[model samples]
Target: MSAATLLRDVFGFDGYRPGQQEIVEAVTTGKNTLAIMPTGGGKSLCFQLPALVRDGVTVVISPLIALMRDQVRGLKEAGVVAGALTSGNTEEETDEVWRNLENGTLKLLYMAPERLASNGAQRMLRQAGVSMIAVDEAHCVSQWGHDFRPDYLRIGDLRRDLDVPLAAFTATADEETRIEIVEKLFDGHAPTIFLQGFDRPNIHLAFAAKDGPRAQIINFANARKEQAGIVYCGTRAKTESLAKALRDARHSACHYHGGMDADDRRNVERRFQQEDGLIVCATIAFGMGIDKPDIRWVAHADLPKSIESYYQEIGRAGRDGAPAETLTLFGPDDIRYRRQQIDEGLAPPERRAADHGRLNALLGLAEALHCRRQNLLSYFGEDPAPCGNCDLCDKPADVFDGTTPVRMALSAALRTEERFGAGHLIDILLGNMTEKVAQRSHDQLPTFGVGKEYSRVQWQAIFRQIMGHDLMRPNAERHGALRMTPKARPILRDEATIDLRRDTIKSAKSGPKIKQMVSEEDAPLLSALKAKRRAFAEQLGGPAYIVFNDKTLIEMAEKRPKSLDDMARIGGVGTKKLDSYGAAFLAVINGEAAAQHPQRQKLAGRNDGSIYDRLLETQATLSRGPSGTDKPMSCSASQLAKVASQKPRDEAAITRLLGDRAADRFGAAFLDILRDA
Candidate 1:
């Protein structure tokens, strides 16, 4: 049960990833540890390996059931004994887990924090011979953390009850949150803390001011068509609509939100883990414990609540140390929305103000002038050379002396008694003699028309940057009226200068199209590899990466492995995978047609599954009828799924499936797709 033996024989790795061995050694030596490793930095191994070398079952208090189950599944695959007691499990599954624990067979037992509420939880762990307590998403224990869970507060009690050393892990935590974690979990007792690097260099960072955000998301997804990704939305409704839009684009997409039934959310989680090229449009509800390592990209349709949330969200991609991409879209509306949320929350004034400051920090990152990685890492107290992986590093933003315009906007706000929001303030500055302006006699103000050199849009951009810089803030008490902060006086008095990114004013005007992953000549081979991967995944009822990740497939296409020895040499093709799937994929690369999954075979030549796909797309597009002239009407999920599965052969059959009224709106388009099919 040596760490090196477990690493080699059980996990199939020769050595530890950077920052893992130290953590593993500390945890194995029975030290109370707090390891702040970045996402995808093998945080699980630090605890998992220690559990193997330790004497008793390691009780893991995880925040999400999906994360626990995924870890258990992966551990079992790696020949380790692990089980999770989750609400998602069936009675039979729970019984099996209890049996394992009672028999002293299971080495790791994962449970949600909420399970701590059970009166027997403490006694159960004590009786089960729990050795060490390892808490995942450990920052959740802190109320100041982005995702605070009240149940996590019980961990310190569990630790004292069991009298076992504890180890906590999280990807993001600031000084305040770290102190909060220490106070809550360790009772202010210092632990062996391992502050690992916060940099995820493999994840390409890009941010854009929102411009036709729906189209921007669509274009981003279309470019990486068939890649697995996640789209995070701010609200539940946005997740649904954005998911629908992506589905209309003929991608295998789904939506997840807190509002959905537990089963539905779990289903989406399962699918995202098991299916290749599946895009999940979800709220923040979906990401904390998702262990899917091969997510090629992540996009945010709206701005997140804070920088910690943003960092954690983008950390989901490129987790396997392969190149992954991320794009985040934000606009003035997002800023207002976030500010309103913070202001309206029940938090005290100081906490709310701190929340606003956090939002401003994120805004600064989004509107950053230098390397985004530098700006982001610097926030976490890390300093590194300019990373060429971020959008800013690749294409420096166009900045201009926005001092004059900012001052003008600030003056107009001050002269107006700071009672107006951006819209009214902009109108007053641009000398717009509108109904509101004339009614209020804003036209009579000296500040009026002083900013006529900049158009209304330009003035709006100036104000956004002003707010972004924390020079001005919207007072929710005054119903979002613009008010200058202390930071503004330095600029308004003509004593300080400010620069604004010109591109922020223009918004993200359709940039160059996303480049494909491989050369055109190699694309077909990559497609073949993907096809083989999908088949293997479907047969095994696991994620495609369980067969081979995209990075491995890209290597397969590039290397065109002709033998088992060659396939085994590719990264991610460990002994177990080579033994299980090496020959099959090798046959595919050798130009032999691979067997398709039955589900895939059914849609292989049928207009690319277009008959039903277009039906769904057309129905979603016309859900409100042509030109939105009718009441919102659309097929139910079951109806859409049936059509995709059944593919009715004629118009009469299609009409029978969908009623006449519904058919009249989409019958022709449906039949046309069927004809083409």
Candidate 2:
């Protein structure tokens, strides 16, 4: 069958996503290839579709057992015969996969890289008529990568032993990691390289300085009620606590971390795959090969380790090309924590310094001025026009000339012999007269109180920005002390100037307001479609998106398709899904059926769903007057949601959003709920 025929008939995509066609063609044409497609960029199809065109079974070496199983399950669901041989497999599962492989019925055989170390494994692949080898998470082969696997080293030898063409894929690889992948996977041979654009334009980029972070995360999740999302935390313990917090806030949240038992982790993975709108609060341990395509949002409860890790984590959202949103929270402590982690690792000093540089790059991204998409793409060697989807592009950051303040902070660190951290340095700069400052005799220094013009908080922001610019960094050897790098000398000497975002200096106001995926008029229909999706998912025992993704559902809500034919024309609805779910979903769009799942039934007719129901009711109660005493006044539905989320503290804040008349009527009651909340 032609690739196009397989694409339409088997995979259901009318055409390839950007950069997929070339990689697919390269693999199918018997060329060794390396594709650096971002996460959820259809990397699996690059090899899976090519395996269909190839004559024999394609052996895929994946790093994670969960990843292998998920991919195999997804491929099988699409009518492709694919199986994984993992340690987690039961006896019957292994037998079924072996039978399919021996009979040449399986187009793809998935296995963890560790299996390559077995004495019989190479021989088995040779005898199994393997025509091509695909390496997923190819960066894992590199020792420099965050997720290095020693077993991946055997892949190059297997390629040579089998004498088969190989295709390598990774979402996060820098120049060094790419070189390591080529050296280790291709055995020093260059492959046909395709570094696709890393821009996930559909993901709205946002960042906020950490302030009441747990509340911030809860509010973000509350706004996106009944939508699947992931929250990445830096520590395993934090994941559990955050997950508990989310659950308390009435979200369907679960936690996953490496410290969990294997079965427990697997259960979380399974639930995340099968349940719709389920939030997974996880350490970086999760989300390597998750195939769920309809994740609506992702938020970082703590700073990620590096820029690549941040990109990979956020890339998990908006995979189905529907609009998605992301929020990252960072604090001064997170920077110190990450710096200490790098310094305490066993890596060489140069490597540790490089890691610090990588972290600084991410800090720069968080403090971005112009556009986040443009900033992210520039890191991966692409220079697209400013995508207006990111927070900065949507609402430009408030920036000011920060050269003088940065120089002052740098001067303070310099005069203090670069032995003081932000807290100490800020104390000296703002002339706090702390006991520690006096004990160290820092109050006697010339730079002491020089930055008194700026508050302690502003001084902290200046220092953070200085570090973000890589002009200075925390000295690990000195117990979290701030140290000036050579880059700072130029600024101190007045040879260079810097511009910093003023808003970040004065603590970020709140998370960025994200653009909605659909129009206000279509929101009810979208909710109805989601209700139908949940019913189908519960009945079929799989993720709601596996039946029809958010993109397809949004289109249904927008176009109001009335028949199976109209539904089948949607992007994600295939022949199988259309046959199974088309009529039910169409009934929802056409209002022919009111079969709202119980969970969704609770949210019916409520703006912004249940989390904000109390606030919405309060607004409605006060719509007329304090006691039905005046002409009717009301806030827009969106404004009510905003008030509920922002939880404004006083009448002034409420007045800014609503006019004086509406604020006077409802402002006191709104503040009462906000305070209680």
Clashing pairs in 1: none
TM-score of 1: 0.70
lDDT score for residue 518 of model 1: 57
> lDDT of candidate 2?
0.81
Error of 1 at 637 (Å): 65
Clashing pairs in 2: none
TM-score per candidate: 0.70, 0.70
Candidate 2 lDDT at 139 equals 87
Q: Model 2 off-target regions past 4 Å?
A: 412-448, 475-489, 508-677
Candidate 2 lDDT by residue in tens digits, 1-677: 99999999988989998899999999999999999998888898999999999999999999888888888888888998999889889899899998998787988999999899897988899999999999998988987776778999999999999999999999999889999999998888899999977778788999988878999999999999999999999899999999999999999999999888889988999899899999999988788768788999999999999888999999889888999999999986677567656754545445666777788888888888778888777877788898888888879998888888888788888887876667777778788888778888888988788887877667666766777788886553343456788888888998988889888777633234446566533543465566557767878899877777888877876676655545656778776676566657766555354343333222333332343556667877777776777687777766666776566777889898777877888788878877776
Candidate 1 minimal-lDDT segment of 10 residues: 596-605
Strongest candidate by lDDT: 1
